[model samples]
Every structure is written in C-alpha cells, then in structure tokens.
Target: MGGVTFTAGGSGEITGATFSSGQTNATVSSATVSFTGAIFHNAVMDSLVVSGNSSLTARNCTFTSNGRRGLYVETIYPQGLVTDCHFRDNQEYPIWIKANCMDMLGAGLQFSGNHYQSIAVSCSAGTDIQRSQSWRGQPVALDLTVGSTSGLTVPAGVTLTVAGPVTALCRRFEVAGTLRVGTGNGYQAWLTGPADTRGSWEGIHVSSGGVLCLTDARLTYATTGVSANGATVTLTGSRIVNSLYDGLSTTSDCTVHLDRSYLRLNGRYGLNLLGRVTGRVQNTELAYNGSHPVYALAANVSCLGSGNLYPSNGRIPVGVSCALEPDLTESATWTAQSVAYDLTVNPYGTVLSIGAGCVLTLSPGTLVRGGGVDVHGCLEALGTAAQPVRFLPLGRQEPGSWEGLYFYPGSTALLRHCQVYYAKVGMAITSAGGYVANSQFRSCSGPGISCAGTANPTFYRCVISDNQGVGVYTRDSAAPNLGNLDSAPTHDDGYNILQNNGQYDFRNESSVSPRAQNNYWGTTDPAVVEARIWDGRDQAGLGRVWYLPLATSPAAAFAAPVTGLIMAGATALQAPGGNVEIRVHLLSPASVSLRVCNVAGRVVCSVPDRLTGGVGERLILWNARSDTGRRLPAGAYLLELTARSPDGPSTRRLVPLVLR
Candidate 1:
C-alpha cells in the first residue's frame, strides 16, 4: 500500500483485484504506487484511486472490464505519470483527473469501449496550462488560465463547455470550436457559461499582449462577455449577448476589430472603449443594451469604420471623442454612420474632413471642459444644399450650452452650406483666413462671427441672425471681406444677411476699416444703419465701417411689386451651356441688380447693377455659369432681380428656374 511496486512477469496478468461493493479496488493514500506490466481486469469498483499526497506511475498497464473508472484521481494536488496504459470496457470514464492535475497526464494512454471516453476535469483552484493544447470532446469544469507563450485552441466541431471562467494571460485562446450550455440554436460555435442569470461566471479575459480571435462564435451569460486589456482582439461574425456588463470592453492601447457581429441584451454598453484604443468596427449590430450601444468618450479612441447599426438601446447616440494624433499625416473623413463625434485637431498637417449631412455635437467633458471643435489644423466641412452639415449642442437647445468652433492662428477651414446652432460663439477666427459661404450662424450666445488678429475670412451669402451679441465682431486690425462696393461680380461677392442681432449688426473694434457694402442690414436708412453699427461713429478709436451702398432688400426676397418694373422670363434652362433671358419691363427708370442663386440660397452668379434709361422692356441674359466661369450643375436655381427706383423704394422678384 505504501511505496510498493506491483509487477507481473512478462506477458502475464494480475487478476481478481477485487474490493467490497461501492469501494475502490485499490487506494494509494500518502504513498507512491508503481505498476509495471500489470493487467487489472474484472474489478467490481474503480481499478485505482490516488488519494492525498500520493503519486502513481503506471507503465505498460492494461485496465479493462472494470465496473467503474479505470483510474480516478481524488487528491487536492495529485501527481501521476500514466504511460502506455490500455483501458477498455469500463463502466465509467477510462481516466478521471482534476483540472489542476491535468499536467500529470502523459502520452501513450489508450482508451476504448468505456461509458465515458472523455476525461472529466474539475478544478477548485485555477490552473495554469503551460503547453500548447487542443481540447475537444471533453467536458471542462472550472476556470482555466493559459500561461504566456502558450496557445489553447478548441478544435472545430467540438462543443467545449466552460462552467467557469477562461482567461489567457499574454497568450492566445482561439475558439474555432463551440461552447454552449442551453439549447438555443443560431451560431455555428457558441462559447457559453452556466449562467441561468447574468454574471453567473466571469467571462473570457485576454490580458496584455494576448490575442483572442473568435470567428463565427457566440458568447452569452457572463459578467463581461469579453475583455481585451491592451490586447489584440478580433471578433468576426460573432454574437455576444446577455452579459451582466458591457458585451465587449477594450482598455487602453488595445486594438480590436469587430466585423459583422451582434451584441445585444447586455447590461451596459455593447462595446466600451477606454483610453487611446484604436481599431475599426464595421457591419456590426449593437442593440437592446442597457446603456449606450458604444461608449467611446475617452480621448483618441476612434473606431473608424462604417456600416454599423445601433438601435433600441438605452441611448441612441453613439458617443465618441477623439484627439487626432500630431503624427497623423493622412486626411480623415468622419461619416454620419456614427451619430455624433466630439473631436480636436492637433497642429498637424492633417485635414479632418466631415462628410455631407454629418452632425457634430459639442458636449462638455469630451475633449475639453468647454466642448467645441478646437482646430489648430485644417478642417474641410463641405455640405450640399440638400444635405447640409450641422453643428449642435449635446443636451439643451440653449445658447452657450457649449463652446463653438475656434479656429486658432494658422488654422484654416472651409465651411459651406453648414448650420451652426446654439453655441457660445458660432465661429471664432483668430489670425486665420478661410472661406465661409452659404452657411448660417444662428441663435448664438455671443457674436455670430468673431474675427480678431488680422483674420481675413470671406463671408459670402451667409446669414448671421438672432445672436445675443453683435452679428459680426472684428477687432485688432481684422479686415473680413463682407462685400466690396466697386468690385466686379465674383463668387466672393458678399450678400450676407446680418439682422436681428441683440447688439450692433456690425461692430468694428479694429483700427483698420473693412468694406461691408453689398450686405443687407435690416433696413436701408442710413440713420438706422448708423444706429445699428458700432464703429468710428460710436467710438473714435475703432475704424469706421463703410456702408455707403446697401442692398435694397434681402438677396432672396420674393416678388414684391414696385410701381415701375414688371418681370417675365424663361422658367427653365435646357442645358448648362444654354442661356436664359429675362425681360424686365420698367414702367419708370430704375437701377436693376440680377443674381442667380442655387437651391440653398447662395448667389452663384451676379449681374452688375445697371440703370434703365427709358420705360421699355430690357432683356438680361444669363449663361448658367458661376461667377468664376465654372459650368453649374443641372439643378434648381432662383433668379433674384431687385430694382431700385430713383427714390429710395425697391422691389424684388424671385424666378425659379430648372436646368436639365
């Protein structure tokens, strides 16, 4: 029983190793048992049981026809070497070993015709598997920790049941196999835990430098379905559902790619990205979660892909925040697939381009305490009239709810057909120049546009209205080109609408005068205009804004009959190359200005102001071209004609035209 070697002669057998009913045939307790060339057959109970502090070395042993398992390990930390052993016709498993004692299983052990051919592995304490191993056709019970430099692969066509957690520390754990507990059917492979309720077991964890790639896998009913901590994780065509926490979580410096996957019924966010994690998520559906589908509020965590669906979550918006790295050299485009984004551009040569119809929300505590787009690099946000870009506040629709776009010195931006709403200042340009056309800056807490430090941006056909502060504020020698009085008709010809501002319409706090001639300032009265402007007339130190020739009315003002002029014209143009003729019947002498505007109310072409000599019909021709001689696309346009009589009264007409 203790330190005993039981051996049979060559080609001989050791038979009738019998014991009482419901007892082991032989128990090695606190002893070393060596069996060589021995055959144990026809046992009434288990052939061998290794107990506390006991070790078994079995070589060339044949154990068959036993009523129970051929070999059973019951010690807390069993030690054994099983080699060249043949086991068959056993009532139970050929060999049963605890998960912690799995390392003692050596090669050359054969089994057949057993009730349970697969070994049963149960471990109370976690075990570190140090070697590369493949698991199949086995019922694993308990936690498994794969050591670094090791790999664990669950082979295909096998369902590996994990009653406890599975973790890989600096190693790889791939699930080409299936793991499931219940009878649900959908995915080809399921890695499931015994969670009648959520968080019944801790989920898979891939620690730093570890890689966990799940292909066509389904995971459910765990604390957190999968956690990638500074690891590389890829889940393709997988589903993670019914987790107690986030379905998938990636911590700092993790690279994760989730493609064509589904994450639903999670207790929290479907995918939680923390700190500077970078990857792409494409063609994935994250819905029915307890919280936001994707929570990526950490800085520089941009999952830059498209075709993702987020629906029926606690929050509809997929919150995102990113600070472009200074070393990023490639231009990036933000699409509308991810609902909103809070971004900051470093002073690099990269251009952050926003696609058409994208909405950027400025919320506090995303990139900075005062939420806004702080750009020290270039930003290109061009939108079409039908699908214009929008910048809005996150929570409340109140002014000063968030800071507005701030273009720092040496930064450049191109904002066209954009609507900026409810910000502290709609746009602030400091010693920078950019073109802003066909955009609206409305309902802002401060000035609609603030230009300082020699900023020379062109505001063309823009509307700055209903601001709490001045409509346009210029200081420190800033000379924004509102409009030129005597300049030839060009695309930059300003027809901006500056009205209904709480303070002055145009405030010049700089010593350098800026020409703001062809703009509408609510009324044409010089006294009214002077009263609404804060310039040298109000303060001697500020330069006087020249307001000699004002627009008679708003550029897009519809038909209002004057006493004199009657307008008729071709309603449509056959082609972009073709011309449209307008017949203006002037009952009395008048000065006429014609402008061709796009569907977005942006003036595309302008005819110089000309005086009518007599009261006959005057013909004006437009060639369907922009001011820069570029052929306009075939679309709907408006022909706006304003006629000013010799007296101060003016009349306007809007003619809709369509070009084929």
Candidate 2:
C-alpha cells in the first residue's frame, strides 16, 4: 500500500530531514498514517501536519527544530494518538490544535525544549487536564492574548506560569483559577518582568465591552498590573502589587469596583484616574506608594467606607485629604486645621451654627465637601495666594458637588484670596452684604455669584473664569458692586479679570444695568466685551450692563489710547455705501474689520481690510452686504470692531458702530 500503515505492535523510524525552506517536512491527510516509533526532526514548517479525516497514531515520536509550529492537528473529525511524543525548539506553539478536534494524548507526553507548548481554544463540552500533567516548555516570546468564545477556566491548585504578558481579548475573561508569573511558593502572584520605574511591557489591556473579573487571585510586577480604558473591571479578594506606574489605571468613564483588595508597594500612585472616570474603593488596602494612593486629575473616586487606609505607607499627599471614617458635619467656628475627610457645614439646622463675630479660619488644603456653609453668623476664610481653601465633594471635584456658602439676611462673610470651585453656586447671598476680594470662582455648574433678594456684595480684584454658567448673575434688584467702591468707583479700580465664561460675564436680570467698568475681558476690544456681556443689548426686555472705560490689559485700564487704526464714527454711515475712516497713530501692521451684527448677535456684514503704515489715517468702505450675499435692509445693526494695532498687551480702542 502507498500509505504507511503500521499495526498496533509494529514500529517505524523516520529521521535525518534537516532542511528549512518554509515548507512542511511531513504531512498526513485523508489517510491512515500510523507510526509506532517515528522520529521526525529539523523541518522549517510544522514537523507533522495531520488534518481532515486522517487517522494518525504516532507512539514515541521525537519532533525537534520545527520552524512555525511543531504539530498542527486541525478540524473536528481528524484525530491523532500520541502516547509518548517529545517536542522541542519550535517557533510558535509546539502543539497547535484548532477548535473542536478529537485529539487524544496518552500518558508521558513530554515537551522538553519547545517554546510555549500550550493549547488555546474554547470547548463547549469542557476539557480537563489532571493535576499530574505539567508544562515543560521553554519561556521565550510567549505572549498570549486569549480570545475564546466560551469561558476558559483553570481549576484550583494548577498554577499556570505566564512568562510574558497575558491579555484577554474576549468579551468576558473570568479567572476562577490561579495564574502565576514568577516561580515562588508565596501567596501573591509574581510577575517576572523588569521592575523599572518607567515601565517594562504592555501588561494586561482589556478592550471596550471586555470584562475582567478576578476572584481570589493576584497579579504583580509589570509596567502596569492592569490597565482598562472604558472597560468594566472588578476585583474581589484579589491583590495587584509591585507595579511600576499605577497598580491599576482607568480612564474615559470606566467603572472600576474593588472590594476587599490590596494594592501595595507600587512605584507611583496605586490607583490613577484620568478624564471623567468614576470608581469605588471599598475596604481596600493601598499602601507604600510613591505618590498619593489615589491620584485623580479631574476624575471621581468614591471611598466607600472607613476600612480603606489612605496613607498606609507614606505621608498624606499635598492635595488629597485622608478618607474620613464617617462624613463629618460641622457648624461651629472652624479654625486652622487639616481637613482630611468629607466635611459638611451646618448639616443639621442652626444647632451647630457659626455665630456672630466667630471667625472661621480654614487652613490651606482644607477640603470642605458638600452640605454647604449656611452662615447665620460670620465666616472669615482668608487664605494665601499660593494655598487656598478648596471646597470639594466626597468623591470627585467636578462641578455641582455641593451647595455653595449661603449667607442669611443678617450673616456676613469676608473671603480674601480664596477659591470656591466645583459647587452648585459659588456663593449665594440674600440681603446680607459682605466683602469678597482677590478671590476666584471657577468650574461651577451654576453661576459664579448669584446675588438676589436685596443682596449687595462688593467684589474687588476678583478673577472669574471657566464657569459652566454665567460669571456673575443678578436678579430682582440684586446689585453686586464690582471693583473698588471707593471715591473713584465710577472710574474703575481696574482689577477684576473675567473671561471665557460659559454664558455672559455679567448677566443682569434686574431692571437696572449695573456698573462693571475697568475689568479686563481678556481683550482690549469693546466689541468682544459687549458680545460676552448678556444684558439688554443682546436680549429684549432686559437691562444692559454698563461696562465702559474697560481695562485694555490685565489688571489695568486706560482711556482709549490715541494710537494705531481708530474708527472715527459708526453712527451716521452713508446709507448703503459709505466710507468708515480709521485714523492710524503709530506705524504698525494691523488687522481691521468693520463688522455689522444685528441685535441677535449674528454677523450681517464684514468689511475685511488691513491697515499698515505710519501714524496717519486709513479708510474702510462697506457695500452693506450680509454674510449670505444679500443686500441688507437698513433697520438696526451693531457695528463694532477694533480698528487698531496688532493684537498684544497694549491698549486698543473699540469704536461703536450703530448703523441706523
């Protein structure tokens, strides 16, 4: 017969084929190839490929120096019987088998010198390797990314040593078994990668929609023990220690829940949160980390209870407050002290109130959480410029964490050089007037300062920026005076800097326009300031904001400088077609524009023109064409622009252009 078929008792020897040209040395398909004692060695492709409905029975076969894979037995029907085979020195997996194959292995199957002789596939009927068998493959580039449809479970007491990085790419990777990295009889799972502070390799990365649940397991010693970007990762009774960077890091709104876990001895922060991520650390031990145990930059981490030790190793970090056992609620005069917990002011009624003349001085880095400071008395929180009292939420410091400092009708608050951020409203005053100087209101979900119901607070030298809503909102005859209300109140003390607010810098809902002069709007142009201030100019049935003699630069304002290109007049433009003359004082290159916008803040016409030359004059002519290429009818329009010098810190003039 052409096919080599040996009886059960018969034996054969096939060897001495030492050629490697990326081709298979031996193949058996759709035929009965039986070798009782075969010896195949030195092949480029797999040493033996058994596929289709082939019946292969090889006893005591020795396969060495296979290039790609040692033995590729594929398909569900084909079966091979290897009693005592020896596989060594393969490039990829030594024994490669596809899914759903009826492969049988007898006792004493030895894998002496191969690189990662492991089987990777999912089984619906389940496969079990007894505790007697072991993996004797050499540890080379054996990085494995598991992608099985069904779950892959390793039974108890079988410690699989992963020499290289092991990632799970399936939808769900459950580990009810144990996975070891280093050879030790310790309780922790040891990873054998280089322990440099920077990083070593790509540790374990879980993709989106992937879930990694580790119950009673451990992973240690990699660049990052576990990194999940927008994945659900939960660890119960597990440990991830001895990592270079963070022991576990999550970003992009990933939900990470850790219960009864230990993340100890990491190089950097034990748990790092980036972006808008949110997680919970319940009864977890985070110890001996270089930086803060929990470092969150614009992220949220909710400490569940008191069992979590924050500074289990080093001192408390500069900004992070220690996790308090229970949320603290106080109302008396709070003096200088380190607030290392979630603190609420006046949680119960006026029982623990801050009475009159009781100065409550908060130390620097005092993080007072929500519950709000309901001041029926007096509060004096005068922090320095470098270190300010930070009011935050229990978990994350995002906007709307808590109610802001509320002042009753007779209460008073003197805040100097303080920061009120991440609150529902930065400060709410009702009929009780106070002094707020050199303070900052940032990142508030509501208005920076809501002055209503006969509240008259004076804000001096304040900088309000990056608020989710308006910077200073007033309603119902609530007039909050800005800048120095001294002898030169109308001339502007020239200090407050408000810019880049979500809505308007000054939103006057009252019937009268408030005086907010001399404050810098991040630009020297009046048109930019008028566009940012939401008053009667933009909305009908509302009061306008009186912002004149605006600051040309930060913290300083001068009378309109007679330099660069200056608009002569904008009111009486020659109907339909006219020349808008601009006078040039200093010789400098400038970008000039005669923009005509309606009351609805829409750009109707723009005369693109530039001015360059000595201190003389320049002219811009407009044909009254709207942005949609149509001739605009003369009704009412806002002509505003800075016909002046190049954009810099220098003072520039904004001439009003009210085309009738």
Candidate 3:
C-alpha cells in the first residue's frame, strides 16, 4: 500500500518497517541490518534471495510458499553469526549454504549453536548417502539413490531390521551429514517410504565413517526395521516399533550408540550384532521385542573380549549391564558362568551376586563390586585381604561364579580391604546401604558404583575405575541420592574405620562437604592429612579402628563392653589391626573350655567354662594371644564355644555358637 521505498544505510536498524514481497531483492549495503518482522510472500519471483557483504540478521520472519528457497544466500562468507532464526514451509529448500557454512565454514566462520528444521538439503552430490565425502570440506548436494551408486543420501553407514510384519521400500533412501532427527521436526523432515510388496527394506548399506544419529525420529519399517552394514549409527532418545525383522543389525566393526532410546514390538530379534561387531549403549529401554532383547556374539571361535555394552537397567540377558541402574520396582536377576578367567568389575556398586562354589575374583588392586550383592537380597562377600576377594574365575577362582552382586533395595553393606570382580554389574545397588575405606571396584560393567532408584550408599578410600556408566550418578528423585559425604581421611593414617564407614555416605543434597580428623573415611580426602595417596589409597598401615556392637545380643558384650574389635551385627570380632591389642572375656561359659581357633581349628585359647554365666561379667583375658603363646591371624576369628555345663560337658553350640 506504500508508494515510496525507504532505504537505510551503515549499521542501520529497520525501526518499525514491515517488508512485503513485490519487485526486488533485500540488499544490506551496510555491515548489518536488524529486521524485526518481515513477511516475504513471493508473488512472482522464484527465490527470495538476500545478499549482504557482512550480516543479514532476521529475528521472527515468516516465508511461505516461495517459488524457490525461502531465504537463499550466495555465500554467508566469513565472520558470520546467526542466532535465533526460524525457516519453515517453503516450496523447495527452506535454507541453503555453500562450503562449510557451519564449520570452519570460511576462516572465522563459527556455528556456536544453531537449530535447523525440515531443511531438506545437501552439502554435496553424495554427502549424506556416504559416497565418500569429507566432513570439513564444502556442503554436499541432496540426491540420494543407492550405493556410492544412488548418489548421496542420509541414514548412511548403518543397518536396520523390522520386528513386526509390514511392507515398504525406499529405492532412494539415505541419511547423511550430522542431523539431529528429533528437534520436534523429525516427522516433518524424514521420509517414510510408500507401501510396497508387503516386504520391508531387506538389506542395509552404509559407507565408511558415516554416522546416522536419530533423535526422536520415528521409523516404521513394517516388515524390517533398520540394518547397519558398517556405519556408525546412533539412535538417541528415539523410538522404533512394530517391525518384522529385528530393530537393528550391524557388521564390519561398526559402532552403535543407543542413548535413552527404546525399541518395542519387534519381529525376530530385538537387536543383534553379528560377527565381530561392537557397540556401546546407555540409558535405553526395550520391551516386547521378538525373541530376545539383545543378541551379541564376538568373533566366532571365541566370544571373549567382545565389544562392551552397558545398559542402566533394561531387559536382562537380552542386554548388557542390566542391573546397572536398577529401579526397585523393575530390577531383574542376573547370572554369569565360568568365563575361563576372573570376571572383573571396573566400577564400585556394580551388582555381582553368584551362587555357591562359583567364585568371582579380582586380579589385584583392580577389582570392584557394586551394589546388589546377594541373591537373598542381603549383601555378602566371602573374601579377605591376604587372599584378596576374587569374583570371576581364576585359580580356586577361575571356574567363574554363576552369580554376581545383587542390589534389591532396603539392603546395605560395609566392605573393605577386598577386591570384587568379574560379573554383570560390578556392584548393583539393589538395596539401600553402602561401604567404606580401602575398597576398590574396577573394570566391571557400569559406573563401577551405580546409584539405582532403590539405593543410596557411600565409599571410602575406595577406587571405582573403568566403569560403564557415570563414575557417580543421581538421576531423578525416584532414583534419589541418599547423600554424598566425602569426609577427609580421619584415621591416624587417613583411612576411615567404622562399621558405619566412619562417614555418612548417602549422596543427598547433590553437593558435597569435607570430612574431619580421626580414622579412615569413605568419601574423605587424604590430602587433609599428610598421609594420602593420589589413587585414593591410604599411606597409613591399617590405621587404628575400634568398633562396638550396638546389636542387642549376648555376644554384643563378648568383647565385654567390647574394646578394639571390629563389630559385626551382634558380635565384636576383628578388623585390620594396628599396634593396638584386642582383648576379650567370656560373658558366659558352656560345659567345656572355649578356645580361640584358627582356620585349622587348632585351639588358640582355653577359656574354661567352669566359672562364667552369660553376659554376667565373667573375665576372660585374650591379650591377642593363642593357646601355646603365639599371636593370632589378622582377619576375623570366631570365639570357640566349647561347653561344660553344670549338668555335664557338651559340644552342641560348636557349629552355631549360642550367645549368653
């Protein structure tokens, strides 16, 4: 409706001007021109082209049904910056660029962070389809056919399989370049092949080094889903449902990373990795998929040292690291067999619960056990230091255990000076509880020490190495973090020594606080003391530890008002000894003399049963000595319960000691 044309110059601002398409090109002879709202409806022209020597900044502009490109540029050139722009609903390509329009696009050109929409485009001829193109060079043109054959396309370098039954085909289908399929525009941008002869795209083809990243991209392959020949395909936060063949297939050592993704109602197999194919998966969910959720096999001859796959609580056996991020409600049971060698846990809190005779082992300082550790829902480890706990299988340990640590919920444990290894998840945090000082979980399934929705625990002088998930994770409140108390080493040498781990270990609040002065600490730093090592190990020798049993049982007073003994549930037993001597007395004596015996069961003590009466303050001096005047072993030992009742002598309470 205007008769005159208003032109601005030199770093000009379009104050309150509205530009409508009529008879020309919008030229910014100046270095910069800010447009508030410019509706360009091409009534005749083929393209609404914008040329600028420096920058053409447009904020809230709509270009509908333009003959050609909604906004075309000869070249953004160098030193260009574009932020918060929307390009949509155009006849052809909504936006196009030349060269590395985004990358080192042109010298000083930088794409800090840009969002793109259904901009069906191509950098080069065979760019997306993987006809051998470079990522840093110029942009490829969009013309996907087949092979280096059909020209360039998208979804290159990967494979797929449909789980359910359906039919479709795409003779000209490919995914190339780095496009995040989700962005709420995936459905609008992606191509869904037309109905076919009731058979899905049977085969998959991908070029080398090409990646297909799908974020929130919907794929309904009817008969077959997707297959990756030898491309790095990533399915992130996306979905693939109702397919005849499996959800995915891979070959030629390609990699597939699935994050927070899901695949349901598949046909044959949910997911399969054939011959030497490897993958890394995290936070993904799979349900009702064909026969198995996941099927993976390393090179034929040997299925050992295969690729690594970690799942933070998915469908078990069908996937790797199932118990990883267990939800009390959705936790599943896991098992492992004699894997030839010792199974190792790279992270602490990895779930490893095995049956009897099945040994899970740690090579050395490199072992770790995560959360859930008991099949019965209790946490138990039957290993000691001098012998170091082993989880997988080796010597007396190589036959490998059929079980791994279990993490049920409402469970807790305090383990140290031991190595846990070789299982599904090193230590699965099945229940709610934790540990302290000198414990190590390395080379296991995930984050070594996982924090499932059901558990919250702590660690001291503990080392969680080479795990699958985050070193330490507290995802949502359902997966609440009890608390994280990294108290400074308190022991004389900086290691925490407490049945309670000497420091509160639940990770609550999300923030952490410093520890104090005393004995061993779970999350305490040694630097606070002059005796700390970088590996989170303590330099001090077993530092002093004095535990007291608060349980209401006769043995609770065995160390009679117990002093200098590591306290168990209701018994005051033994701990890593320092220079301190452990003394104890018989609160009540049986019929015979009770002796302190070693593994050999040879009597080490002779506490006569002739005078005591349960918890009755009977004095029985030990002085940390054996019967023949020799020092005892450093670990834990049972206080032999020989009986000499007033009625007669007895041996009944030997197998299971009876407290007074």
User: What would the TM-scores of all predictions be?
Assistant: 0.60, 0.36, 0.32
User: Ten residues in a row with the worst lDDT in model 1?
Assistant: 557-566
Give the TM-score ranking, best first: 1, 2, 3
lDDT of 1 by residue, 608-641 (tens): 6744645544556677779999878988887777
Top of the candidates by lDDT: 1
Tens digit of per-residue lDDT, candidate 2, span 35-118: 655656556667777666666777777777777776777544645566777777777667665433313544456666676654
* Top of the candidates by TM-score: 1
Total residue pair clashes for candidate 2: 1
Candidate 1, position 10, lDDT: 17
lDDT-superior candidate, 2 or 3: 2
Model 2 is weakest, by summed lDDT over 10 consecutive residues, at 556-565
Q: lDDT values of the candidates?
A: 0.64, 0.56, 0.38
Name the regions of candidate 1 deviating beyond 4 angstroms. Answer: 1-128, 137-186, 297-301, 321-333, 342-370, 484-491, 522-530, 546-660
- What lDDT score is found at residue 399 in candidate 3? 12
- Pick the winner on TM-score between candidates 2 and 3: 2
Lowest-sum lDDT 10-residue window in model 3: 556-565
Tell me which of candidates 1 and 2 scores higher on lDDT.
1
